[model samples]
Target: MTVPEKRLHEDGDGDGDGSGANDTTALEEKRQNTQPYIKGIAGIKPEFLAPISSLSSTYTEYNDDEAEGGDRDKNGSQNGNGDKRRKKERGQNQKRDLKQKRDTVRLCVSLIDPEDESTPCVAGDEEKCKYSHNLEEYLASKPKDIDGMCPVFEALGYCPTGMKCRWLHSHFNKETKKLIKDLGKLETEKDKSFEVNLIDRESKIALQRKKYKYEISEQVIKYLDSKVQRNDSHQENRKENEATYVEQPFKIAEKKKIDLRGAKIVSPLTTVGNLPFRRLMKTLGADVTYSEMALSVPLIQGHQPEWALPKAHISEHPGFGVQIASSKHWAAAKAAEVIYRTTQHVSELNLNCGCPIDLLYKSGQGSALLDQTPRLLRIVKAMNGSSGDIPVTIKIRTGVKENKNTAAHLVDRVLNETQVAAITLHGRSRQQRYTKEADWDYIEEVGKVVKNWNEKREEDKEGRDTNPTWFVGNGDVYTYEDWYNGVAREGVDSVMVARGALIKPWLFEEVEAQQYLDKSSSERLSMLDKFAKFAIEHWGSDEYGVNSARRFMCEFLSFTHRYIPVGIMERLPPKLNERSPKFVGRNEMETLLSSSDYKDWIKITEMFLGKAGEDFQFVPKHKSNAYENTENR
Candidate 1:
């Protein structure tokens, strides 16, 4: 398979005139200086083979100089200028703003439902209502209907967004002036409950008014206060007699046990792991999924935005886990109690002790818990005592710094101190971040320790309530080989995938097949289309919803665009650390899919959602093209 030559930009702006002719003699001269060849092996689908005329608008031209060591310095800053480039933001954006203002006005909530027209203002009289109830005025100033069928209405038999839907024309009766619904389909499809973990209006109001009771959490906290010594150093060992004497306020109920021996689990990702993405993963073949890590403080305070993190699709149940981060025992206890009381779909409640972001670590949460083992154990104990039958799990890293691995040493303490159901080790220190490869050898050692501890408990004939903790390893499991190798180890039960799943959602499918399947460009596009539809269904079909879906879709593409196709690789399996050399695809669509430019990502989103507004803009969280010096921090 011959590879195409890298196309050069004719101008400095990185946008060149559309041209196809190649100078063979000049290409041959430049071939010796280029990197290894990578070609597109799969055949292109006819429907996705776009015309060259459209390519100019859809594709961002790569600058020839930038691809071949241009004027930029090693720090990715421009040269020959006294002005220095602004350093890119790292970790979480403290000023992250997602408030999307719509270009046009919207109708009042009271007027949205055609069936409930009698109660124009349920909160009060219609004259006192603050929202605009003028339907005629709203329709007149509403943005033009988007050009496609409403994906939510098409699948669910009805659109919940009602008249506010951008695709209003698709399911609206202009003559009757009523939103349409497929009664027959609704009756046939029995389960209308698509999502779970939603706090009711009364519960939310109660929380806001500080009227909701935390009876279980209060009891647990009071008991802990009576027994635990404040200001005690974590290094000081507790007296052996103290362990047998101190009892919890009440006996912990028998919880549902989870066995992750061979399960393929998706890690609790932050921004990208939303409900729509998890639903897409479930369809692809993931056995387990986790919600984005919710902060315990906000959850206990009844903040609606934080509450949205725990909402899960119906298909995710029986394997779904809700993860929460807290620095204090009270917050963890109260949050766990509330989640247990309100949610029926959760299989486990996971405490996050592995998040390495500066914002979390500085706040005495996440990896900071590694240093404060006493506080961490107290938080875990409080959660276990409060969250009735739901299993409790925790995700931790090696330690806080390099060359000081503490996870193996902390294993015995965790086993003896808390009744956690499972332990997931991420195999990297908080300081290590992604600078170096994950230390799986250390993870295996920790796994062995956990396995031995469980065996010793079994041999000692511990009480029936004493459950054996499952050990799962995470980090850098990108392929089927990685999955098999991890599971085949002596003590590791399963693997939890993060960036790998984001790059290839069909990773579980490959694990089942036990071989690499070279996906075509068209197939990948189809996957994106499915995600788009799911996002629309989950977010809504309004202008704001469409843009929200588009923003997230772009985020998904940011990670996926790094995937180097199996067919093109000179080697068998790709390494997470290795970078791909500059290469063009056999076809234009395939080339477009491989683009790292955010502009190109926006162009891809436009393929599903209509053309973005002039004001629509996206700045990726990380600079994918920035050079990394592995030797340094």
Candidate 2:
């Protein structure tokens, strides 16, 4: 109600009598005017007042003009009807804003990006994700991260957007034109030997034909029993005969070690894994290391180079892991068989389904494996058949995107479909690539689901085995303290490190020591030396090798540089450009030997490549900026 009018009426003075209301207003005005003078006596400014909204409400009934008052020029100086017109204009503007939001935001989406794009669209788009290709190769060739996802071929309209097709980019580009652009040279300097053509209808048809021939042949080969070779039809089919072969289930070994107070991490980055690297990690006190990812098709083909990736070093004895990427049952089975035969060093066999790289995702491998659960079951079952004493594992992201986490679904599948050794989860969706946080909460949620699943599995006649697949978490773990925080939680088993380890090899050691061992610059230089020796053995010590080794060293250094933690460096706040903590003397060399850096890495590579070898050329991988979501978040 209008305070003054209500006051007049409440005082038995009718509003019809303008005299009484005016008198009350005059009295209120006099009181307000005297407030400043009274404040001077008390030395207090009249700071407290009734809320404007409430005061305005009380005054509301006094006059309709007051109701329309706020609507007038907000300057509070406008005449009555002016407010009404302004109110109308405000409503119109609000309506317009809403309409704009509806039209533009219906299908808006934010996607995770890779660190590099020049190699392959592991998840689909390159530009959206800032991820580069493989770093080792990038350092070797260009010493720089490139600007594209895939180099050999670019598909037209091949984005993995599915139904959310925005059709925003050029479907194809001429190879020659792109080459000129990439070389950063003028067209006059372009080589004419190779031709580039956009993917047209004719080209697509030819591509389809090639795919049909390849895929159909592969499918047929996989369908045939191993013992059913045409030339050996007359021979005894030992593997295929009913008496010789039977569908069996996976068996999980009891936990050999009792320590369960840590994070269980798994890596989907098998391609970059190698014996030298895994061994180095083990030496560094890492809890575990995954084998480079293996492909089911190549294993079925018995390709020598492909099979070589699964090979374990003599030092990879206890915690070695073998990870495979596959979308078919027989292929998975075949790959597992090859891994087991080549490496007794493995404790776990991981299936990759979190990789968003277009090569793996588009082929129904990696994250694509999440879609065909029944198929995944079949594949895992095949692995179980020949798992032997080793455990079977799986690596995956949360889901495709849009807040969907398939861990709950896949957790159940892993529990019921096949006997798995463990599940390693990278928290971001496959669509996120390495652009966001690793999603620890979701990882915990998955952990809970797995725990619940185990209880149910134990109760079921079919899933009577008490051995549940262990839960392993990965993504963006940088510090030892972060590692402890993650695994020390109830839901986690053990954590895995990728880029963190690459950047700081001494992380595990630091955690084990329970104190920071900040290495000096000279000490870091020494670590690079050891890495060089390892690289030499892997790449050979020739000129063709040395240059390549130098390049990869730089790559390793790039990651290593990120590890200089804040506390140890006596130099207050640490900056990448600032000097790292120096050892008291040269005595800190051992600590430095445990670290990494591109410069030291190259120095190390020099030992192997003869100091003259050129670096391998390719793309760089991206580190996710979504630290809060995937790791810290």
Candidate 3:
């Protein structure tokens, strides 16, 4: 038996066209040397042959840079057939990847159905008639207003008629309404504040595809099918078949040390790092999560509430690192000591020096530390020295202002001055604030520099088993290929995901499985419910706690909607920039995000912060597209 030979074959028709490229084949043939090549030695898997052999040569059929008359004469254009076929091939690969990615892990929500009498907790705080009766009896038995001092639950506001903290209930309720009214006003005004493009029903899929294209960018080829569209009848059947998909989760719990000496994480990207939310991320495959950056004074003061900022569930034990900001070394040391001594569960203590907001900066801390490296160094050294057994970390930016690129130098200083566990460098300068493309090339350069420095140190001191400090790359790693390139580019130990992780908790799910998940709205909402439970469980379930949870959930809804596969109620993965069928509740959040009006996003934010949102503004540390939309901030 003779085995056929294989190569990338193509049809070279006249006029440099892709015509008659019906099906060029890649026949697997055997090779021979001094010894004859055995039959079946090439070993192309039979099952994958159909897809592999279907593609003609992948050589660019347009450019003539290589050969005269080899390039197209028509306005730098490619033969339409080849372009279309290439697009189709790309789409097929993406679909296959999505399947693999979504198959990694599935998150489960714990919302109790109000109608389930057999259960104790009812729809998260709401009670059935029997429970309501019991609650009334319990409250009646308690002495009303015993201490005259409102309880933390009540002072922050949770008591009253019907067990509702009327203030918080009203606050959460009104914030939602105000957000809608503001959005309505924006619609009437039209493109004044920002062009609100709600991801709508008709264009949800188109928008999702567009977002995928933008996110993947140069990482992977997107094969789109047009001329030979899927068989609608067969497509529906196939869709139904694909709907029963689940992700196999990989639980990584080994105690690996982290390094954050010269790193930079957006200070307090809270919603995702909090309980339930962080757990969701872990289930989705996140490697690290910083506790919402805590305030140093409160933390060291032994304020019981400040511990809340640094608290973590056992699930987040090894991966959870507490981040805190301080202007003084003593305060930083005190906070680090308290956290290390108090929470036997936390893995590392992170020093946050990357925040750019005015309040924190003006108060002599946060990104302001960028302006004072010596002070920052002192704080880092203090934590590194004082944090016993526990590792110490730091997050830093490229520099204080735009012109000064201090990060590479800072990494050098940190290496020289402190023994940190890991570093996360947000590629943007303090001034840039998530406005532009990250300087990944510079980050790679810094990683190489760190590696070289480590080598030199080892050479200088023999027999000293100096562990390699982990260097995590941050900024704009949105897809599997992006992650693949970022992690493998140089000595980058891992990647710290902030917004991308928040937008799609399952993003790490893709990186681990080497694919993407086409999550539905119901699925995304379920994750939100888990986050809410985690928040309530962590923050407490009193009126204040519940209202705060609802409020933040609304804030999260802004980013979350961006990840919800559109057409959730009826379809899946809504149009990228189109509005949803309507903006109503959580179901409508995706549409609001699709619109890209920061006001709508901010309006949703007001749901937690309360009515006079116009008076205060939140500038996201890593605001994507903020360069073009700086006016919004």
Candidate 4:
């Protein structure tokens, strides 16, 4: 458990020769006396760890009102405190009225046609479509001139949201007295069929009919079950048959090796790692990207949301992986079967055994699999059997607890018993969270073990047909230096970035240049603009779509704001965990852009998407402790 104490710049760059010895001694003495302003928690000296209270309580608050105007009243009315309070009250009332008006404007609508045979209309069925059927009423309410058209209707031939869509007027042809349908824009019959399927009806029907079967998964699961049953029954004779069981070989289909050496991988982030974000990362230089962790049970049951996770943008090929979390072998196998059958974009199927979220762990999925090694093995084996040609990979942690490190043992078992193509180990245990630095020393130790195993396996087999499992290190890699140092030290093939990518997606760009990038405010704004365009393309440019884009934009801003511009930093290579003192940006726009307020994030989005409707409101996925001071605003 003892980590070797090494200086950050120990590799060499010091002038410590006999020449200018007196000058070097003086410089070293000065360096020892001078305290460097470390970013975030790295600034805390090891000696101060015990006396420091909660790290969360130490952050300095930045008051927007003070930043905006030094002496102006809250309302900018030049009035006394009473007048300012009254104006604030009036503003609150106005916001409430706007919210009420938006509530009255229904956004969801029925797309079902009562006359169509495929559209079921059941009387007294509470779940049946209750949307207004009177087209004339909707037509009369429409304005004389349409400002914008519905992009969904233009692309997909029909509007799925129907009359409730805010842009219905643009899609509806008044003279013809019917909704316009354009089939030419659709790329394939399958695409057209999916549009007609509407609300995942076809998927549901297929699931209910049992049309999809996990042929390979079932066979593997059955085989594993029989072995377990046989072992249990022959407990008394287990020692006699132990050698036979240990040497048992499992059948695996031939597949090409997956090589991800020096690849820039963006971890599959929940809520934030949508298709649009992955597409953006690909454009920025991400070599490998994974889908958000889709639950296997939902994918097997044909849930639309779960199925959507596996869908990759056309640009994200060659190294696109679909990650799934499952507690049971059947669910993992069935989900893999569906992906293999339905999609051709997947390069690998990754089992998520490192997620530390309580809900997932409590449900016997995610990091819980780390504790249940036998079940984890079965799930991977089943998934591999079902996923034809697509290699199975796994993402794991050091272990579940701080004291016990089981990842090396797990790696040994996987290498010996399974045909997994790769393994990614996040260097922290589930209990460690982000409080401590990643255990790179331990990761290096495990990497050595894997290397030895691979060498031995290669010596045994003259042919290189069998692919050695590639090892990847994850956790706390933020810059080119970190990536280089981790890979060089741990001997990992590559590293996966999660929050680092979120905070500064251009980390890959920095890695490509092998240096830090001090992006200007305008350049940063342009990046946001590009993301907004991508979001509009994926989510559509309609009112709901615009709002959805803005919400996610705000989410991105929440992370992006944490990026301290290199120009303003006191040091090189900012730490991910560092907090900054109150400071204004170089320009007003930059200052506004750097504001942690969600309202300011919306304003930034408005520069791209136009002004948000009065009805628009956004709550960040991860709540900010700073919001308590300005929540009323």
Candidate 5:
């Protein structure tokens, strides 16, 4: 299915009224031009497409002129595809490179003067301490404490950042010069609100020191090497020794089972898929969530940022999966083993073979693995052998290039060669990216093959593993109709929502209701408000924390601003790629919510995260200067 180009509505407000709307001939032409390719399976009602003003009694009325024009880029003329792309690229400042770390005075935790009087500073030798122990000097150099109570301390009962926290005045007593704490609340909320999968100091030290054991990984590698050498022998000898060749040291059934049939999964979006966002997805009814892809080399080197990817909220358990990308078996096995040993919250260890970024692809990771099936198989086998009681899964695309699809052939090889618990097939090839529509037909074709393999496994269960491997379909699932349709497809066990969920987080809620929900702008704002609160809880409410939350919030807003309200659409079901013409919303707030300007996103964040300081700036990863009317060109 292809996305139809949007036709410019000269004077119509899209409410099926006014001069353009009254032209029944023009309306018919528009409908015929932009008809949906995939028919709705969930019995989509025609009334659902009615304007918001007619559907909702509480909707604020506005002038037709107010709905005519929005914030359209002057340079964005819809002359051609090149011009449209240029207009879209105008929303982003591609060269806005901001320094990650700020120049600020920070004090060590040991010299912070503990809230508990009985506790002594860990740094006994004051002069030998690496960090500044001169509390008075450090305090004088520190910027004034930010106003307002620290949301982290208020919610989580304690501030892990302590004296270094930018909102230090909230918990500090001026006269006594002592930090304050809610000791009772701290004890109760210790394990509840805190994030899981934190590697212990000892474990980190051992890994860095090269003292961490890799017995299981070493054994697995040794076995794989022996098999490679044995392949040089005669066919009869190889067949005779097949029984003695152990693929894995343990059984696949012993690992935690992943049941994804008819489940709603949130894709592990890079940068945007943080702990707070996943937590928000859980509230919206996501059945499964994955951590952002971690680099195996960094993970093996005990990198904190890579390790942070595995940290999940308490609510994510039994469904949270940690994903890692690697090109080699040693790196993959060691990374998987470390994560399995350190984290009890992980349901499955997923190998990311679908990332199409040039950096990862050039490094022989991500989509590069698709071309090297043997290496990919070895990596999966090694992960299974090393990762105790943790199910291994893989996410792949149709192929590395357009026209030439290999996922079906690769699926057969993967099912026969490895003990993967689940396989997620993204319907787009690496070459396709977002330039074209996802090939769901190809996804279903692969899913059917997996189904056949699983059925055969069920029929002959002796000696071979009997567990049925699940097949999940990913790409371009935007609405409840799209979700239900994908799941109803032959052999597709579930669907993974990515950009769709980012744009409308309540998508899962809609899927559960099995209908279109024309949520008010206020309702959508409330969801963003909840996200801000969750972000503060996870990242803290101090200056650094607030900035972190604000930055990510802006990242979220970058995608969310694309949601053209269902009520304003001329058709029944909205396509994910359909670019709407600049049109006003039911209210002023709604208009702001649908803005493509990055500045408007900042204004939205200011409502929840307080004013972004002069030091703060946000540059969207993608440009979004929506098309302007041709007359303006």
Candidate 6:
């Protein structure tokens, strides 16, 4: 199914009234265009396309100006001093909050002697404590009308926040006058092992102490450092004798082969590709999933945030990969070794060389590595050697700039110099961002190169030990048709989905079923409910947990709202670049779900999470530049 080149309204069908005959005509055209293009699926009924009131009261587009109006009024040009004071007060408040949190975590009651004055109270001194030591007082302070218990305490048997938890009334026993600590309950709960998969605190300490052995990785790092220290002319001579200097490839009698042919793979999205989302994607029929890109330096330095990236749901195993970005051989080698030592779950260790974020690019870690072919090769080779049994892979773009495509050369080099198991080539240059369509022709050409390389290698008896690298094409794959057509291209084994999956995570389900599924508004809400459940399970169901879930839900909605319902589209298989024209849905709930307004997203979250506090506010990750460019338009 193909998208129409022009929208109905854009084709000069408007009657200047902005309401009346022209509007009715456009709605009819939209209805006619809603016929299912796929062969098997039943076409949308006319009733499904019947227009509601043009002016939707249930939905309103969120205006950033309106949201920030109060702030503007208080901190406008006339209140420069007040703005500065407010900023200073905010900073002070943040510091105080951090200190208080630390104190709360550090507080511990002496289990041996609760009455000892010398022993610090985990609940602090009873006289000055913010929390009630008596269960009766805690119960009295809580609302008499409140419903339900603390989900975290109910699931884990113990609350990590202790007295500070907002649901303190839930776990405290009035009859026994004691707090129940049943932490072992988590052991039996299904899919609640996210924390168990992370690198342990002791392991991190060992890493920092330089006590954990990484013999092979250390050796590779030393060799690469020496190579870097050599004079430019000597380095050139070393390149001429590259075979002599290169480390001998490690070999086993047999290695596990990775086959991603026709696999539904999700790309490593930065902030949006958290564990809950990957788990959701797995349930939705995605064959492969990757963690968000982590920086190698932070991983080597034992940073908690970086280490968290590699944690995966047990269900994602046998197909989950942890992707890392690095500019240096040592960082890449060491990080891979750490991952190898820490977990048995990773299917592959992938190097990310296609990230285009300015900070990453400027740090010489991401797409900037494209300009330094020698360094890039060294990092990939080092990671391949250090990552034990897991296969090494790399993701790259066409190139860093427009008009010049360098991926073919890089792919050829990797195939010859390193034993990488796969290469994913995003068919657009870094500079292109999302401005233009991905260059599929160039991707097809690169696929041919890989195909020829594999054919030639197959004919050579000695090269059989070196794994046949799979070629995966990425970009603009949104539907079953796109997935099928992409893999059908010569040498392409599979496709990697990014924004497409974010916009419609059930995309893999569609690919598996080989048909368009026009999901009902209720069905879509059910998907959101699943995500919320996952989030609450992973992040806990405490006050902070609920807020974090809400924030991430909004982030997910930012993309989900872009899904123009197939039953309302002016054409079959809507293009990713096509923006929706304002139109109401058949029902108020559907219209609310369709709204792009951040306010509406928050409202939707409230349906599952209860009312948000007044302090709750959210801004999308990608700011709309439409307002800034309006003058030009």
Best by the lDDT measure: 1
lDDT, candidates in the order shown = 0.74, 0.47, 0.48, 0.65, 0.73, 0.68
Q: Mark the regions of model 6 whose C-alpha exceeds 4 Å error after superposition.
A: 1-196, 209-212, 232-255, 622-633
Report the Cα lDDT for residue 563, model 2. Answer: 49
When superposed on Cα atoms, how far off is each prediction in RMSD?
9.5, 24.4, 25.1, 12.0, 9.1, 9.2
lDDT by residue (tens digit), candidate 4, 441-504: 8898888877887788788865355888788998777777788877786458788898788878
Candidate 1 deviates by what RMSD? 9.5
How do these models rank on lDDT, best leading? Answer: 1, 5, 6, 4, 3, 2
Candidates sorted by TM-score, best first: 1, 5, 6, 4, 2, 3
Give the poorly placed runs of model 3, Cα more than 4 Å off: 1-256, 259-268, 460-463, 564-633
- Let me know the TM-score candidate 1 reaches against the reference structure: 0.83
Model 6 per-residue lDDT tens digits across residues 492-581: 989999888988889988887877888888999998877876776676554556677787787677778767677765445555544344
| Pairs of residues clashing in candidate 4 | 40-578
The stretch of ten residues in a row with the least summed lDDT in candidate 3 is 95-104
Number of the predicted model whose TM-score against the real structure is largest: 1
Write one digit per residue (lDDT tens) for candidate 1, span 1-633.
Answer: 112222232112111222323322222323443523222111122233334343322322221111111111234422112234322322212233445667366566777766765646754766777666788887777677878888888887788788788789998999999889998776665364388889888887888888889878998887775556734563244343246447654877789989888898999887788899999999999989999888898898889988999999988989999999999998999999999998899999999898766556668888889888988899999999999999999999999888799998777798987889999999888776654668889999999999998888888855434877999999878888788878777689899988789888889999888878788889999999999998998888878888899889987887787777776654545655444434456577777787676677877898888777765645554444232323321
The TM-score that candidate 4 achieves is 0.73
Q: Write the per-residue lDDT of candidate 5 for residues 1-633, one digit (tens) a residue.
A: 123333333222122212323333332333345433212111122333224332221111111100001111123231212345743433333344444344255555575555544545556666666667677777786666666777678776677767766677888888998778898999987777768888988888888888888766777766665455244556666555554665644443367778999888998777778888899899999999999888898888888877888999998987999989999888998898898788888999999898776566777888889898988998999899889889999999889988889999998999988889999998877765554567888899999999898888877857255567899999878888889888878899999998889888999999988878998999999999888878988876556777888888887787788787777665556666544434567788988897666677778987887777778856654443222223311
Clashes counted in candidate 4 amount to 1
lDDT of 3: 0.48
- Give each model a TM-score: 0.83, 0.53, 0.52, 0.73, 0.79, 0.76
- State how far residue 440 of model 3 sits from its true place (Å): 0.4
